[model samples]
Every structure is written in structure tokens, then in C-alpha cells.
Target chain A: MKTIFIGAGNVAWHLAMLFFKNKNVQITHIWSRNKENAELLKDKLDKNIEIYHSLDSLDFSKTDADLAILSIADGAFESVLSKLILPKNCILAHTSGAQPMEILKLANYNSIKNIGVFYPLQTFSKAKEVDFSSIPFCIEANNKEIEEKLTSLANQFSQKVFQVSSKDRSILHVAAVFVCNFSNYLWTISETILKEKNLPFDMMKPLLEETLQKALEINPSNAQTGPAIRNDEKVIEKHLNMIEEMNLNSNFSRIYKLMTESIQQK
Target chain B: MKTIFIGAGNVAWHLAMLFFKNKNVQITHIWSRNKENAELLKDKLDKNIEIYHSLDSLDFSKTDADLAILSIADGAFESVLSKLILPKNCILAHTSGAQPMEILKLANYNSIKNIGVFYPLQTFSKAKEVDFSSIPFCIEANNKEIEEKLTSLANQFSQKVFQVSSKDRSILHVAAVFVCNFSNYLWTISETILKEKNLPFDMMKPLLEETLQKALEINPSNAQTGPAIRNDEKVIEKHLNMIEEMNLNSNFSRIYKLMTESIQQK
Candidate 1:
């Protein structure tokens, strides 16, 4: 199958690379707002692939493909779609867990027919190597035929694939924010707390990794341990006092109290 | 070296097993208020380890050892320490990250000469198999000789060992709360969000694991992603509205906003 990729960010970079290596897939073109990013992505893969600077000036006929994958940022979807023109029957899919396939349908009101979502539930970094086969791919489309095609395509990249509705995908996105983004922010807090004490952040590495592994081994509720879960008011008070004494953000105390309450309620 | 394990809780169970396996060490006695817990711990390992129901009832003459590790809860530390009777030179230590070595020092003010902290920084579940060799063991003592002996014992079970003061260990404990307890609570919230949507929590495993791996690969601040870091007020607003619409915990929305603002500030 022939595929045209849009965007050159982390998601696009990884997805494009995965598709480029597939024997049955051909990346006809890669487009990004910054020509330099597009060139960088192109330069990382087969140099023969076409590259475009803007979706508005693209010659769809010259780079026409069976599929067009939109891997741009969630906020840029509508604006980017406003400038796009695609050949008839070209399947349109996005890699955003937060966006629905209807956004693509609405954007292409009369010009597009087949639109879908191909959300991969994994965080990507351009500098790291991602084993795509292990990541879960959530695919959805307006109809079964398109969904089946998308599912087959996704299956080529990953062993774990599921058909999730737009509503469910949005819900997943919120959860993803908690597990990935919010938990990560907690790590930053951990680093900050250690930094102030002149303690090595490396000291927490084994504990951090073990905690994550513990969650997978059993229910997180069962795995939970600390002053909050134990409801040790003395330790909790001591921590809060220390936070205040250290002149840290008030949010730390707020989060600590709320989480402790939640764990106690559970 | 010989040791006496006080409290047959999760930490004590794994630790006793480690000591029980070491050719150079002998677990002289295992004490727990609940005889059943002590017996269970004993049954899991060598059958010869003595079991006791209370520190006050423990016959220290028959079970005297070079080291006494109080693995009981922080709340019970003082009460338990008040009941203990040991040989003059027997070193006393605790397996708590929050409690200071001074508690032991104060508890045994007239009788005890050596007090220290031997805190293994990992969440333990009795049912799970824990490989202690990789876990970080933070050791601290009132004197250099006691500190060296405790460090030597800790090194037997773990390669990652550090000599941290009671003050610094307390600081490390607070940071650990953010990384382990608070982060696990975030996982609980993620599970709740998915459960309300009738979605399987297993679907999030890959994303959860990848997020943790990313944090370890680079600084969490640099690894941060999602609408909050991007300062995409639109997506953030949409997520908050969705949380409100679902009638989930108000705390969820509160946490979402606070975390978003915190990430943006950084």
C-alpha cells in the first residue's frame, strides 16, 4: 500500500520510519510546515521519498497515495486540514488519541470520503529507538471496510491492536495524561525535592523502577505504600512542614493531602 | 553475623529470606504480634528460624545476635523499642525510610550503644518474588563502626548501598512518596477513568510502561508531553470539561488543573 505522511514531529518521525521499513508499504511523500524538519525526516530514511513544505501548495496528483496519515499535533488538525486536498478514496487517518475521525470528515466536508483514526498508545521521543511491534495501536473508522483496512495496516506494525471508539479514545487520552504526563510531573517534583536536599536523584532510580514494576505485578491499590497510604499523620505533617519550611510550591502540599485522602478513601 | 528480625511484615519477610539464604548470616529470631505472620514467614524459608509474638516476650538471652532489625510500622517503633532487651553491644536499626535513627537512640538511651538505619528503598509485596540484590539500601548510624557493620550487612543483600543520614533519608522518603505512592495514585485515577468508560485497564499497560521508561531515559522535565506542557489551553479546557461531564471525582479536575499549571510554570 502507498502512504503519504504529514508532520515530522516525534510521532510522525517514528510512524514514518516504521511504515518506511515495511515491505508492503511505500511512503510516497512526507510533508511538514518546516521544510527543514521534512528534509531531516527524509534524510533519515530513503532519500528518494518526496518531501513538501506546505500542505496548501502540495500537488496531490504527483504524490497521490492509497492512504494519508496525519500525525500532526492535536491542536493543528483543523488548521492543517483546511489547506489539504486529497485524491478521491484516499483513506485519511490521524494519530491523535484526543481527536475523533469526525473532525477529519467535517474538515473535508465534501472533498473526502474515508476518514479514520490510527492512535498509538505510546509516548515517542525522536532520539530513542521505539520497538513499534510492542506498542498498542487503537484503530477506528466510520465503517467496517475502512476500519478493517486500518486494522490490517496497524497489525503490520504491532502485535497488539484494538478498535476503540472516538469517545473511548478520548477517555484513554485523559488516562494517558495521568499515567504519562502527570506521573512524569510527579517525577519532576521528586527530582526537585532531592535537588534541594543536595541528595542524588540517582538514589531514587531503583525505587522508581521497582514501583512501576510493582504496579504491573499486582493492583496498584495493593502496591501503594507511603505516608498517604499508611495514613501516618505525623509523617504527613512532618513532610508538609518541611515543604513549607523549604519554601516549595503550595501545590505540593495540596497534591500530597489530596492524594493521601484519595488513598485513604480507597 | 547474626541478626534478630522484629516484625514479620512484608519488609521483614523478604529481608529475613535474604538473611536466611546468606551463608555468613543467621536469622536468630523472627518476632511479630501475630504468631501466624511469624510462622508464615518462617514457613516460607528455613524451618529452624525461631518465631515470637511480642518484643516484650522475646527471650533475648536465647536469641541474642549482633544486629536487631526492627521492621515494624513507624507508629509501633517507640512502643516496640521500649519492650526490647538486648546484649550491651548489639546494634539496633530500623527498616523505615521515614523514621530516624534517633528514635532508636532515644528508645535505648541508657542501655543501647549502637543505633542506625538500614532502609531498603523498595515496595514489597509478600506474594511477589523480590530480588534484593538490585534494590537500594540506605544505611545510617550514630557511629562509624556501627555504620560500617550495617553497611556490610546491607551490601550482602544489595549492590546499591549508600550511607545516608537520618535527615537525608527522611528527605529521600518524601521524594519517594511522589515517585511511588503519588504516581501509583495517578495510576488509580487512570484506572478509574477507564473503568467508568467500560474500558479495560490492561489497554493502558504499554503506555504506562513506556512513560516510566521515558522518565528514566531523560529528565522528566525534558521528557514531559501532553497538552499541559504544550500550553494548549484548548485541549486542557476540553479535558477538564470532559472530566466534569463524567461526574468523576472533583479532586480529579482539581489535580488536572494544578498539574497543568505546574507543568506550564516549569
Candidate 2:
């Protein structure tokens, strides 16, 4: 399969590298609004993959690729989609958890024959390596043929593939926010609190690791602990008072109070 | 070194097992309110370790032990300390992160000569085996001699031992809540959301593993992502509308809004 990547960001960079390494698939073109960014991604792989500075320059009539992947930002989806010119048989897919598949169809309703979603339900960082086999790929398409084609493509990288509807994927994205992004913000707050006292953030390493391990092993509801879940009002009050004394910011106290109340509600 | 354990809870059980395995130290006695609970802890190790149903039953006068550890609940610390009568030369330590060492001294100021704090900064579960070498031990004592003695004891189990003051440990405890307990609650909420959509919680494994790895690798503030930190109001609005549409408890929506606002403020 020959594929054209529509973005040169983290997701596109990772996917392009994956496809380039797999003998069965080939990355033909890499596109980004910035020429330097496109070249950076292209430089990571073989010289055979073409780099494009603008989507307007690509003539669908001149390309042999039929699989075009839009791995751009969610906000840029519609704007980038409007500028795209693809072969009539091209299978167009966007790698977004929150965006719906209908947007792809609505963008070029008359011109495009295939529209799908190839969302990888995992956080991506360009500096780190990802084991694609463990990452879950949520695939969706307008038709059975496209669904099977996308599933087959997903199977090359991951064994965990599901045909999730747009609605379910959106819900999954929200849940992912709570687990990945919001939880990360909690770590940031932890770092801030520890830094205020000149304590090392590394002190929380073992606890952080064991917390995740326990959650994976048991239901998180059963795995809950600490002052909030324990209903130790004294400790909670003391912590709040200390936070008040520190005068770092109000969000720390707010988060502590709200989460405590939420846990108690459960 | 002969040590007497004053509780048979999760922390005590794990600590007792660690002491029993080490050739340098000996667990002289295990005490719990319920006789059966004490016996259960003793059953996991050698029978030579005596079990006590009450602190008053075995006279501290008859014991050759100089190190008595109070591994009981934070709420019971004062009550347990008030009842204890130890030799003048013995060192007394309580494993609590929030409680101050002064509380231990205040309970029986004239009766006790040495007071200290030995806080193992990790969550413990009875069924799980923890690697003692990696767990951080926060040591505190009233005198330098006792502090060094406690540090030597802690070094037997872990290389990561630090002399933390009561105020700093209290702050560390609060920081720990954000990283461990509060983060675990986030996972619980995530599980609840995914379960509502008939999605497997296992789908979040890769993301959870990577989230922790990234946090440990760099500053979490630099590692922040998703709609919240990205300030993607469109996706955030979509998520809030979906939560409302699901008619799930309003807590989900509230958390979404507050966390998003908090991230934007950062």
C-alpha cells in the first residue's frame, strides 16, 4: 500500500516512521504548512518519501497513492480538508479521537468515494518511542469495504483494533482526558507543591508507578486510598490549611476540596 | 536489633515480613486489637515472633527490645501512645506522614525518652509484594543519635532514606495525594465513563503506562497535552455537551469544566 501523510506533526512523524519500516507499506508524500517541519519528518526516513510544503501543490492526477491520512490538529481538520485534492478512489481518513467521520465526508462529498477514521487511542511524544503493538487503534468508515481496508491497515501495527462509532470514540476521548491529560495535570500540581517545600519530585516515583500498576490489576474504585477516600477529615483539613499557608495558588486548594468531595460522594 | 511491631495492618504486615527476612533484625512481637489479626500476620512468617492481643497484656518491662514501632492508624496514634510504657533508653517511632513527632512526645512526655518518625512513602496492600529496595523511607527523630540509628535501620531495607521534618513530610503527604490517590480517582472516573459505553478498560493500558513514563522522564508541565492544555475550546465544548447528553452525574461535567479552566490558567 502507498500512503500520503497530510501532517508532519507528532502523529504523522510516528506513523510515517512505522509505515516506512514495514516492508508491506510505503509512505509516498509528507505534507505540512511549514516546509522545514515537513523536511524534518522526511529526513527521519528514506529519501523516497516526497515532502510537500502546501496541499495546493499536490495534483491528485499525478499521484499513484490512494490512501491519504490527515494526521493534523483537530482545529485544522476542516481548513486542511477544504484545501485537499485527492484521487476519486482515495481512502481519506483523519486520525482524531474527538472529530467525527462525517466531517471528512462533508468536506468533499461529491468528489470523494471513501471516508474513514484511523484514530490511535494513545498519547504521542516525538522524542519517545511507542510500541504500536500495544496501542489500541479505533477504526471507523462509511462502508464495509473501507472498514475492512482500514482494519487491515491497522492490524499491521496493532493487535488491539475495534470498530468504534464516532459517538463512542468521542466518549473514549473524554475518558482518555481524565486518565491521561488530567491525571498528568495532577502530576504537575504535585510537582508544584513539592517544589514549594524544596522537596524532590522524584520522591513520588515509586508511588506513582505502584498506583498505575494497581489500577491495571484491580478496579480503580476498589484501589482508591488516601485521606479523601478514607474520610480522614483531620488530614484533609490540615492539608487544606497548609496549602492556604503556602499561598501558591487557589487551584491546588480547589482541586483538593472538589476531589475530596467527589471521592466522598462515591 | 530486636524490634517490636505495634500493629498488624497492611503497613505492619509488609514491614514485619521485611524484618523477618533480614538477618540483621528480629521482629520480637506483633500486636493488634484483634487476636486473630495478629495471628494472621504471624502465620505469614516464623512462629518465634510473639503475638499480642493488647499492649497491656505483655509487660514492656519483661521485653529486651529497645525499638518499638507504632505502625497503627493515624487516628489511633495518640491513644496507643498514651497506653505505652517503654524503657527510658528505648526509641519510639510512628509511621505517619501527616502527624507531627511532637504528638508522640506530648502523649507521655515524661515516660518516653526518644521519639521518632519512620514513614515509608509508598502505598501498601496485603496481597501484593513490594520491592523494599525501591521504596523511599522518610526518617525523623528528636536526637541525632536516634536519627542515625533509624537511618541505619531504614538503609537495611532501602537506599533512599531521607531525614524529613514533620512540616515537610506533611507537605509531601499532600503532594502524594495528588499523584497517587487523586490520580487513581481520575482512573476510577475514566473506568466509569468507558464502562458506560461498553468499552473495555484494558483499552487504556498503553496510555496509562506511557503517561507515567513521560511524567517520570521529564517535567509534567512540559508533558501536558489534550484539549485542556491545548485550549481547544471546540473539543472541550463537544466533550461537555456529550457528558450532558449522557445524563451521567453532573460531577463529570463539573470536573471537565474546572480542569479545563485550570489548564487554561496555567
Candidate 3:
């Protein structure tokens, strides 16, 4: 399978590298809004591959690439699609969890017959190496043929792949925000609280690890335990007072109160 | 070493079981306000163990126990201490994370020479079994002899033990609420969101596991990702709107907004 990458961001970099190492998949072309980023990604791949600084300069009709993956930001979908001209037979997919498949069908880009979404449901960072096999891939396509192609490609790298609809994917994205992003913010708050007292953040690591493990093994709601779930008002009031006494952010107290109430509501 | 347990709650149950397995420690006596609970705990341990139904009936001065562990709730500490009497040489300790060591210095209980704290820093559930080796035991005592005895006992069961001060332990407890309790509540929120959409929460297992792994590998402040950190107003607005559309708990949106603001503030 021949593929072209439409962005050189974190998602694109990781996907391109994964595909580049696969003998069956060939990354033929790449482009990004930033020329340096495009070049940086190209340097990581085969030198023989073509790097396009501007999408308008690349002639999609003349290329034989089977797929064009738009791994750009959510806001860039409409603008990127307007300028992107693709071969009628080539499959076009965006690697976004929030956007729908209809977003790929821009007014000028209707000539592109195939449209799909190939979302790798995991957080990506340039500094960290991810194990592609463990990451779940959520595939959504306008039609069966395009879906098969995307699923087959994802199967080559990942062990878990599912055909999720645009609606379900959006819901999954919301939940992902809670588990990944919001929980991470709570972790950041914990780190700050410890820092103020000269306590090493490392002390919380063992508990953090066990919390996740228990949540996964048993359902999170069933596994929940604390002063909040126990409804120990004395401990709750003491913690709230301590947070205020320490001169921490007011948001910390709000979060603590809200989370405690939520846990009790269940 | 001989030990007496003042409460037969989760902490007492787990600790008694652990000490029962160790040859160096022996649980000589057990008591709870509810005699049934004390009997339930006694059944789990050796049949020769003595059970005290009321603190008033037990003659503490006549018992040969060297240590008495007050593993009751924070609210119950004062009432339980008022009725309880201990031998002159017996060390009195509570397995609490929030209360200060000075809390053990009750007016009538001042006759007791030694007081200490043995707080196992982990969330315990009756249904789940925990590995004692990994749990960090925070030990605090009024004097060196009692501190050494508690430290030696904790060392027998756990690989990690620290002499945390009362001020530091209280700070640690607050930090723990964020990382363990608060983070777990966010997980419960995620589960609720997915369930409302008829989506399997199991689908999120991979992402949930990786989020913790990433936070621990890279500092959570630095590991932060998602729309909030990106200041992606488009995605944030869409997620907030979606949360309202789902008719989920209003607290979810409040938590969402507060956490997003907290992340960006840093």
C-alpha cells in the first residue's frame, strides 16, 4: 500500500514512522504547513521520499498513492481539505477523534470519492516512544471498501481495532478527556501540593499505580475508596482547611469538594 | 511483639491478617464497638485470640500486649480514646493519615508513656488483596523507642518505610486525595459518560492504563496534553457543549471547566 502524509505533527510523525518500518506499507509523500517540520519528518524516513512544502504544489492526480492521511489539527480540517486535491480513487482519512467523517467532504474536495477516520486512541508526545501494538485504533469510513482498507492498514500495527461511528467516537473522545486529560490535571495538582511542602512527588507513585490497576481489574466505581466515598466529613473538612491554610489555589478546594460530592452521589 | 487492635475495620482486618502470617508479630487481642465485627475479624485469625466486646470491660493494665493500634475512623478517635485505658508501658498508635500524632495525647490517657503512628499509605478494599511489600508505611512516634518498634514492624512487611512527621503526613494525605481519590473519581466520570452512550467502558482500558504510565515516566506537569494545554478553544467549546447535550451531571461540566482552567494556569 502506498500512502501520503498530509501533516508532520506528533500523530503524523508516529504513524509515518510505524508505516515506514512495515515492509508492506510505503510512505511515498509528505507535507506540512511548516517546511522545517516536513523536512524533519522526511529526515527520519527514507531520503528517496518526496517532501512537499506546500500542498498546492503537489499534483494528486498524477500520484499513484493509495491513501492520503490528513493528520492535522482539528481546526485545520476545513482549510486543509479545501486546498487538498486528491485522486478520485484514493482514500482520504483524518486522524482525529473529535471530527466527523463529513468534515473531510469539503465543497471543493468532493471529487475525492473515499473519506474515513483513523483515530489512534492514545496520547502522543514527540519525546516518548509509544508501543503501537497496544494502542487502540478507532476506524470510521463513509463506505465499506474504505473501511476495509483503513482497518487492514491499522491491523498491521495494532492488536485492537474497532469500527466506531462518528457519534460513538465523539462520545469516546469526551470520556477520554476525563480519563486521560482531566485525570492528568489532577496529577499535576497533586504534584504542586507536594512541592509546596517540600515533599517528593515520588511518594505518591505507588498509590497512583495501584489506583489505576484496581480500577481496571474491577470497575472504577466499585473500586472507589476514600474519605469522600466513606463520607467522613471530619477528614474532608480537615483536608479542605489544610488546602486553604497552605495557600494553594482556590481551584484545588473546588475540585476536592466537587469530586468528593460526585463520589458520594454514586 | 504483642499487639492489640482497637478497631476491626478495613485497616485492622488487613493488618491483623498480615501480622498473623509473620512469626515475629502476634495479634493478642481484638476489640470493636460492635462485637460482631470483632468476632468476624477474630474468625479470620487464630482461634486462640481474645475478643473484647467493650473497652470498659477490658482491663488494659492486666493485658500483656506491648502495643495497641487505634485503627478506628477519624471521628471516632476522641470517643474511643476517652473510654480506652492502656498499660503504662504499652505504645498507643493510630493508623490514620490525616490526624496529627498529638491527637493521641488525650488528657486521661496521658498515663501512657509511648505514642506513635503506623499509617499504611494505600487504599484498601475488602474484596481486593494488596501486596504489602509495595505499600509505603509512614511511621511517626512521640519517642525513639516506640518509633524504632513501629519501624521494625513495618520493615518486616514492606520494602518502603519512612519516618514522616505529622505535618508532612497531613500534607501527604491531601496530595493523596488528589492523585488517588480525585483521579479515581474522574475515572468514574469517564465510566458514566461511556455507559450513557451505550459504549463499553472496557474500550477505554488501554488509554486509561497508558495515561498513568506516561504521567509516571514523565512528570505529570510536563506530561500534560489535550485541548486545555493546547488552548484549543474550538475543541474545548465542542466538548463542553457535548457534555451538556448528553444531559450528564452538571458537576461534570463544572469539573471539566475547573480542571481545564487549572491545567492552563500552570
Candidate 4:
């Protein structure tokens, strides 16, 4: 598979490097809104790969690349698509969890036949190494042929791949926010609270890890514990009072109360 | 050191087992309001150990127990302490994150010389095996003598032990709820949302693990990601709409909004 990579952010950097390592995939070109970022990504790959400063400047006719993977921000999808021109038969795919595969149809070159989504359902950081084999790849395409192509390509790197719809992909993205983003925010809050008391946040690490492991082993709902689930009103009241007394962010009290009620309601 | 174990709940079960395993510590007596539970706990240890149905029946004077560990519920503390009698020299302690060591002063046996707190900062499920070596043991006492005794006892099983104050211990408890209990609830919400879409929750495991690993390595505030941190109103609105469209729990939308606002404010 000959591919052109767009975007030089975390997701793009990881995916481009993965593609470069796979013997079956050849990353022939790279592009990003920021030329320096594009150069940075190019530096990580074979030196022969061409770097394009703008989507329009890339001559799709010259490379014969079979696929173009756009790993840009969700807000950039429409604008990037509107300006991007691709070969009539080349596959165009966006690696976004929130955006629909049909969004790829907005590419300026209307004749482009295969537009799809190659969404890798995992958090990525350029500085951290990711084990791609276990990450779920949510693949969606305009038709069976495109779907098979994308799934086959994804299978080369990941053991888990699914033909998830745009609607379900969006739903998964929301769930991801809750589990990954929101839970992380809660962890940040815990760290802040511990810091205020001159306590090391490290004290919570074992419990945090055990909570996650237990939640995975037994469904999370069944693994619930603490004052909220136990309905220990006295402890809850004490905590609320402590939050107020400490003059911590009002959100701390609010979240504590809301989460407690939610847990009890469940 | 000879010890008397009180309560038969999760905390009591784990602590008794740990004390039983340590060659330096001998669990001479066990008591719980529920005789059946006390018997069950006793069965897990040497058959020679005594099980008392009531705290009043446990002759602390005869047992030569230097340490009496109360692992009962917070609500039971006052009632238990009001009726409990301990030897003058026995160290009386309670293993609770929310309760203060001073609460042990309520013991009817006023001559008791030592009162302290032995709070293992981790969640325990009776069936789950815990690694005591890494668990943070937060010890608090009325004086230095009792502090060293409690610290030395805790050190028998755990490498991490701290002389935390009652005030700081309660603060740590609140923080523990956010990081462990509350975060697990968010994970439960994610599982529910994914289940509604006929998607396997397994798809989220890698991302959830990575999110936690990242938060621990980098400060969680710095590890924050997704629409909230990006301040991407479009994606946030889309997620909120989808949550409503799915007719999911009302708390889902409320939490999503609150957590998003909190992340952005941070």
C-alpha cells in the first residue's frame, strides 16, 4: 500500500511511523498545515519520502499513492476536505472518532472513489510508545470493497478491528471521553487535593490501579465501592464540609456530590 | 506482638490474614458482632485461634494481646468503643480513612495507654488478593511511642508507611474517593454507553489503561486531553447531543458537561 500521510500531531506521528515500519506499507508523501511539523514527521521516516507544505501543492498524479490518511483535528475535517484533491481511484480516509466517514466525500475531487474512516480507538502521545497490536481500530467505508481494503490494512498493524458505523463511532468517542478524559480529570483533582494536604499523590496509585483492574475484571458497576456506594451519609457530609472548609474549587464539592448521587442512583 | 482482631469485613479480613502470615505477629483473638463472620475469619487462620461472639466476652486481660485493631465500620465505632474494654497497656487502633485516632479514646477502658490509627490506603475486596508491600499504610497515633509501634507493625507487611495526621488522613480519604471510587463510576458509565450501542467494552481497555498510565507518569493535569482541554465546542456539543439522542441516563449529560467545564477551567 502506497500512502500519503496528512497531519503531524500525535496520532499522525504514531500512525506514520507504524506505517513506515510495516514492510507492506510505503509512506510516499507527508503534509501538515505547519511545514516544520511535516519536516519533523518526515525526519522520522525514510529520507526519500516527499514533504508537501500544502494539500493543493501535492501532485497526486505523480505519486500513484493508493491511500491518503488524514489524522487532523475534528474541526479541520471540512476545510481540509474542501481543499484536498486526490486521484480518482485512491482511497481517502480520516482517522477521527467523532467525524463520520461520509465527511471524506467532501474532498474537492468529487471523482475520488474510495472514501472511508480508519479510526484507531486509543489515546496517543508522540513521546510515548504505543503497542498497536491490541488497540481497536474502528474501520468504516463507503462500500464493501473499501471496507475490506481498510480492514485488511488495519489488520496488518492491529489484531482488533471492527466495522463500526459513524453513529456508533461517535458514541464510542463520547464514552472514551468519560472513561479516559473525564476520569483523568478526576485523577487530576485527586492529585490537587492531596497536594494541598502535603500528602504524596503516590499514596493513591495502588488503589487507583486496583480500581481499574477490578473494574475490568468484574464490570465496573459491580466493582463500585466507597462512601457514596455504601450510602455513608456521615462520611459524604464530612467530605463536603472539608471541601468547603478548605476553600477548594467549588467544582470539587459539586462533582463529589453529583458523582455520589449518581452512584447511589445506579 | 500478640494482637486481637475486631470486625470481620473486608478490611478486617485482609489485615488479619496479613498479621497471621507475619511470624512476629500472633493473632490470639478475633471478635465480630456477627458470630458467623468471626468464625469464618477464624477458619482462615490456625484452628487454635479463639473466636469471640461479642467484644464483652473477649477477655483482653487474659489474652496478653498488646495490640487491639478495630477494623469496624465508622458508624459502629462509637457503639463499639463505648462498650469495649481493653488492657491498660494494649494499643487500641482503628483502620479507617475517615475516622480520627482520637475516636479510640471513647473506649470504656480509660486506662488504655495507646490509641492510634492504622489506615491502609487501598481498597480491599475479600476475594481479591492484595500485595501488601506496595500499599501505603497511613499510621496516626496519640504519641511517639504508639506511633513507632504502629509503624513497626505496618512495616512488617508494607514497605510504604507514613505518620499521617487525622486531618490529613481524612483529606486523603476524600482524594481516594475521587481517584478510585469516582473514577470507577465514570468507567461504569462508559461501559453502559458502549453496551447500549451493542459494542464490546473490551474495545476500551487499551485506551483506559493508557489514560491511567499517562496520568501517573505525567501530572494528570498535564495529561488531560479530548474536546474539553482543546476547548473544541463543536465536538463537545456533538457529544452532548448524542447523549441526549440516545436517551441515556440524565446524569450522563450532566456529568459530561460538568467534567468538561472543570477540565477547561483547570
State which candidate has the highest TM-score: 3
TM-score of each: 0.94, 0.94, 0.96, 0.94
Q: Write model 2 residue lDDT over A175-210, tens digit each, in one string.
A: 999999999999999999899889999999999999
DockQ of 4: 0.75
Where model 1 places Cα greater than 4 Å from the true spot, the runs are: A58-62, B46-50, B58-63
Q: What is every candidate's alpha-carbon RMSD to the true fold?
A: 2.1, 2.2, 1.8, 2.1
Candidate 1 Cα RMSD (Å)? 2.1
List, for all models, the DockQ compared with the true complex. Answer: 0.73, 0.73, 0.81, 0.75
The C-alpha stretches of model 2 lying farther than 4 A from their native spots are A46-49, A53-61, B34-36, B46-59
Error of 4 at B125 (Å): 1.4
Count of clashing residue pairs in every prediction = 0, 0, 0, 0
TM-score: model 4 vs. ground truth: 0.94
Scoring only the A-chain of each prediction against the true A-chain gives TM-scores of 0.93, 0.95, 0.93, 0.94
B17-63, model 1: which lDDT tens digit per residue?
A: 88888898888788898799999988877778777896677546445
| Model 4, span B32-148: residue lDDT tens | 898888888899997988888665774566567799999987878887887778777998899999998888878865667789999999988776778889899999988899999
Candidate 3 regions with alpha-carbon error over 4 angstroms: A53-59, B53-59
lDDT of 3 by residue, A1-266 (tens): 78999999889999999999999989988988888988998999999888886757546667888889989888777777777887768898989889888988882465688899999999887777789897889999988998998999999999999999998998899899999999988898889999998999998989998888889888888888889887899999999999988787888898899889878887
Candidate with top DockQ is: 3
Indicate the docking level reached by candidate 3.
high
Model 2, global lDDT: 0.86
